[model samples]
Structure formats: structure tokens, C-alpha cells
Target: ENNEVVYELLADMGWTGDSIDLDSWLPVYCKARYGGCPAAMDSAWQQFRETVYSSLYSYPRFTWQTVVPDTRRISKLDVSDSFLQGVELFLSCADSLESSPLYVNDAIEYASYYLAAKADDCYKRALKEDSLGNRVAAMQQLDRSVEILLDVDKLLASHPLYRLEEWVDMARDWGKTDLEKDAYEANAKRLITTWGGFQEDYAARFWSGLIKDYYIPRMKLYFSEQRADLDRWEENWIKAPWHNTSTSFEDPLQSAIKLVERYKGE
Candidate 1:
């Protein structure tokens, strides 16, 4: 259960049968991890369960995270009201949850997801603007999308679990020599970026350094009509020196509060 963590896989073996009653599981999991669960958080988790624990989503990413900035992707889900309500309820308890690493990390994670949804909206709007021949308007929307992604990267930096620097640093630590360190670091970057043919973004993650370093530039190149040497450009980045500077907000809870109020229900 711990290793093969996906319940969907267990369903086929009749181990899960179907949904594993999150109502019963969440409170216990919360206690084990955070010592206690607030009523608001439980209600928020129930609201979120409609989107997360309710289904077996095949893709872990949104349309904006695709290899190219195409808006035709099937996983383009509209942000649901339940998800927004959950976010509101979750943020309402920020004062209570701020001290717990697990809670703070969850706040960062949830905020990042909401921001990604907002970014996808901008992405879709950009494409629509382009279709209407509004080049300047389209670029504005595209630029806004990029801004949101950078914000996401910043938000995720405060999170221990989702930060790209954490992954890359662990890769570097696995090496006994400088050459091996460079190789391992390159592998780590590649796994998140060009994870090989036909699977370039199958497991796309919106991590801190990854968003600014990889996705930001990819979106620009896609918009600039520079399709010729994109693959080589990615290779260059993979083999390049590890010089990405990690960044984060000092008070992630307050940062989250500002972010939520700024783009609430957008």
C-alpha cells in the first residue's frame, strides 16, 4: 500500500473494489500527520474529494504543461466551484495550520494547483486572442500566463515536497565525483523535461526551478515560431551547468493569503 501508492491500481485486484471512503480515511490520516484535523479542514477536504479522491485521472498535468502551448488538449478541465470552495475553506484556517510543515506544504501545493488552473485559463485566452488576429492581446495573455507560472514556481519553492531544487540537490548528493554529480543532475533535469521520445511531458511537473527554467522558455519559443532547434535547445539546458538559484517567500502562509485574494475564483 505504501509503495504501490495508487489506489486505482489496487482496484483491479479487488483490493480497493472502488472508492476508499475518504470520509473515514482523511480524519485519521490528518491526525497521524498533523496531530489533529480542524472541522473546516475536514469540510474543505470533503469538498476537494469531489475533484481528487473521486476519480482516477490518467494525466497528472494540465494543458499548459504540454510539450507545446496547444489549447486542444483533452485534460483542459474548467475549475469547478467545489474546488474553489475547498481552497477558500482551506485558506480560512491558515492561522491554525501555518505551523505544521505538512499543513504549510499542503497549502503551497494546493495554491500551486489553483495557480496552474488560472495559468491554463490565460493560455486558452491567449490562443483565442490569436485566433481572432489580436496579436498584441494574445501576447499579453501569453505573458500573463508566464507570469502566473513564475508565481507558481515561487509558491512551490516554499514547499519541501514539490521544489525542484530538492530533487536536483538530492541527485547531486548521490554523486561521489564532480563528473558523476553533473551527470546525475543532468539526468534529474531530463526526467522532468525531455524524458525521452514521445514522453517529453507525459509526467510533466510544475516545480519551482522547472517552471522558470524550462516551461517559461518553452512557451515563448512555441509562440515565437522558432520550431527548428527546440530539441537541441532542451539538450543544451540538460547538459548545462546547474546554476538555477532557488527562491521562496519567507512567510508562505501570508504569501498564500495574498495570492488567494488576488486571484480568487479566477
Candidate 2:
């Protein structure tokens, strides 16, 4: 595992440590960015710069400079739904991780994007009435989503056992509606079956986490009639029938990957 992580880290940085490249784009770019540093500083600088570059312009129009959430504010906020939703937006945009640690570090960010957007809609309605009760409710949703993000982030970063499957089990144990449990089970199984290899590739990793852990399960809630066989369903939640987008990368996951690659290239 240690060697694998090292190899991946080096490959990501265009390092040959010893292999010959049949086709390489990262080397020249690496030279351009870090050729001036001392040998000892070169690798470190390259890693740092690579992370920053990927974080900003890797997807769509996302630039690393884009502001989302301040982690320091997590404890200070009133725990309102809208505020919590903002935290979700932060996680969705890949703001929680200090640098380009790994795609999973940004897991919460992606989850938050969906959750915060929904919470934001609720807050809009609550704004019309300006009722304390609605305001509190909205905040509660945001807070819950944030809490979930925190857990997912940690799982993605340090623990392989805490996969989406476990999340489904948690939902079931929480004694959610039968409809919810069924939906959760179906999606969790899909993730495990489709992309559970623990592969190091970012695309595979992101898809595994998002599809299995978040997207499909969330859809189950909308179907009041419990689905006995969710595997038979062919709906694409990322590009749901209700979502309208003129761009090919408008799908949230795709957009996020693009952003990551963009930042890496910089």
C-alpha cells in the first residue's frame, strides 16, 4: 500500500523515479514549473504547485480562487439550514481539503452541492414567511448535510472500510422509511458492484463514491412507491429529466473532474 501510494503520487507529478515514458505531457510542464528549484525542493514544489493548479481551473470555469466556505466558520455559524447549505456548497466545490490531497477529500463538497442546492430552495420559501420555525428547519437540513459531509470526508481520506455500503447500512439502522432503505440498499450495492475495486484512478474513485454513496440513494426518497429491484432502473440522476443543461460537462461529477484536471495542468 505504501509503495502504491508513492507510485501514484509520483506518476501524478510526472516523475520517472525510474521508468521511460512512451507518451508524456506532464514532464515538460513539470520542467517549466519547477526546473528552477533545488533538487531537494523540486519535488515538493512540484507537488504543491500541481495541487493548486488542479484545484482551480481543472473543471469548467472553476478557478481555485473561487470562494466557497471557511472551515473555521463551521463552529461559529448559527447552525441554520442556509448556513449549513453554504457549507455543503463548500464541500461540493472541493473547498474542504487543504490541497489536492485526493478526490475523496472533496467528497463532501460534491454531496453538499446537491444537498445545499435543495436546502437553498427551501430557504427561499422560508424567506417569504420569515418564520423562526421554517428558518430553524432550513438550518437543520444544512447542518445535517454538513455533518454527513464531515463523516464522508474522513471515510474517503483515511478509512477504506467506511465505503458507501456502510452509509446505506447507517440509513437502514437509522430506521428511515422502508422506501428509503430500499433505495439506499439498491444504490449502495450498485457502487460496490460497479466500481468497488479500490482502484487509484481519480475518475473511478469519484464515480464510485458519488453514484454509490449519494446520487442514487437520494433519488429513492422521491419515489414513494418502494422499488423492489432498483438495479432494473436505468435513470441517470446526474442528468435527471428535470435538469436542463446546454453543456456536455454540466453534469456535476464531470464538471468537478474537469475542474480538478484544470487545476492540475496549471
Whole-model Cα lDDT of every candidate shown, in order: 0.75, 0.34
Question: What is the TM-score of each predicted model, taking all chains together?
Answer: 0.85, 0.22
Candidate 2 residues lying further than 4 Å off, grouped into runs, are: 1-223, 234-266
lDDT of 2 by residue, 1-266 (tens): 22232355466658455665412433443333323223322343233333322233212211000112222222111223333333333334343232434334333343333333333333334333334455455445434433433333333323333344344456456547876666666554444333333321112222224432343253333222443444334234322212111121224443443443332211
The ten-residue window of minimal lDDT in model 1 covers 1-10
Lowest-sum lDDT 10-residue window in model 2:
61-70
Per-candidate alpha-carbon RMSD to the true structure: 3.6, 15.9
